[model samples]
Target: MIDLESGYILRPVNPVFIYFSLFCALLLNLLPIGNYGWVPDWLIVCIIFWNIHQHRYIGVTWAFIFGLLMDVHNSDLLGLHAFSYALVAYIAIAWQKRIVALSVASQALHLLPIFLLVALFPLLMHWILSGEIIWWALTGAIQAFIEALLWPLATRILLAPQRRPIDVDHTRPL
Candidate 1:
């Protein structure tokens, strides 16, 4: 079983953790499910975590790439998720300092709008490109709510301390 708190690997700052998280996000995205009332946006959750903690390593480019992968996997318009994810990444990076400092509860509150924007962007794009408004707007809204609810838990998991043994010096000559 992978450690949900410390991620799948032992190395704290390893790029592999990011890659693993992204891969898991993609897997979660592709999980087969018949039309659901609300499906949590797993990729966005993962993206937010990495962007908040590893902004220097994972930025807009990484978001774009993973978003494009999502596009290919889901067989949606090529640039739809790509653009939305990149925009979210940009926003997250722009607010990284504030986000990093926020309490988990506050971060969840902040994530509500971010997830709403993520949901809205795709719906708006689909309407514009297909010239048909999807009736699932309500469903998407609910999914955004679910995503927001999941944010604090996800953040706590992602930000958990990596060191297994807290080092302390117990020996001294007095």
Candidate 2:
């Protein structure tokens, strides 16, 4: 009996906030710690969040650009991150209406597969290139789980600025 309906009525999101959040996420992803298996891709998380919540402002193009930046930062295969990011963005946008209506936990469950795909891309690419499947690459599943766990928190924080005050007073029109 999970509730698909969201309780809050959010105001229009500010374009500036979206950009600032994306910038912060990119900076976070650039941190050296991000390369570790324990750290989920912050940029990808933000990109998916925006794609699901604010499709008009953020889309596949943004994901591709950020992915390219990450590729350069990691010096990994060119377009690897870009392609995965674009794929994630496209999926999120495609499911935007259904996802937005779900409870945060439900949304996380729905997003798990997309995150897994993104996490496994590197391992998949490596296997394709070297003709060897690395069992250690399963650790990427941990990162995918972490990303899924982060969805509720991300939804809470990112939507805070736009949420209408709980205690609506006559003094406030909005």
Candidate 3:
């Protein structure tokens, strides 16, 4: 499909590539990097990328499953990450059309708020349950900015696989 707005012709995405990317993102998130508030959530970034570009294949259900896995890995309250992931997935889906139409740079601007909500959901939930706010968690907002900043680069990398060959041949007309 040729994106009329972006002028990029994209071939059908390989299911294998999608799964591999998601798995890699999950592994990255599961790495033993201490709970650093500024570290961007690689899994969610991957999820959002697919949500915007391949929503039919990657949706909220996938997000929930990845969230649950992270919850187990982190040994945190079960379903907390699941809920946050699903919430962000839903938001991304809701705005997928608009996000898809924008330039990659503009798309980052739209994602900033979605990232903010994802970053804050955990802290808000924790405060409500424990009645003690973890002020350090507030720094997680920085992760959102970092993710937004990297959006353009991420888009280029993720879309690279699907971009049609620039030199069209009669044998392959995408």
Count of residue pairs whose backbone atoms collide, per candidate: 0, 0, 0
- Each model's TM-score? 0.83, 0.90, 0.92
Sorting all predicted structures by lDDT, with the top scorer first, yields 3, 2, 1
Q: What is the lDDT of every predicted structure here? A: 0.77, 0.87, 0.89
Can you write out model 1's per-residue Cα lDDT over 18-121, one digit (the tens) per residue?
78877888788889974364888799889977887788788999899988987887788898888989999999888878876667778888878888887888
- Candidate 1 residue 150 C-alpha distance from true site, Å: 0.8
| Model 1 misplaced regions, further than 4 Å | 1-12, 35-37, 161-163, 166-174
List the lowest-lDDT window of 10 residues for candidate 2: 1-10
Top candidate on lDDT is: 3
The 10-residue segment of model 1 with minimum total lDDT is 1-10
lDDT of 2 at 77: 94
Cand. 1 TM to true fold? 0.83
Higher-lDDT candidate of 1 and 2:
2
Score candidate 3 by lDDT: 0.89
For model 2, what is the error of residue 93's alpha carbon versus the real structure, in angstroms, after optimal superposition?
0.7
| Model 3 backbone overlap count | 0
Q: Is candidate 2 or candidate 3 better by TM-score?
A: 3
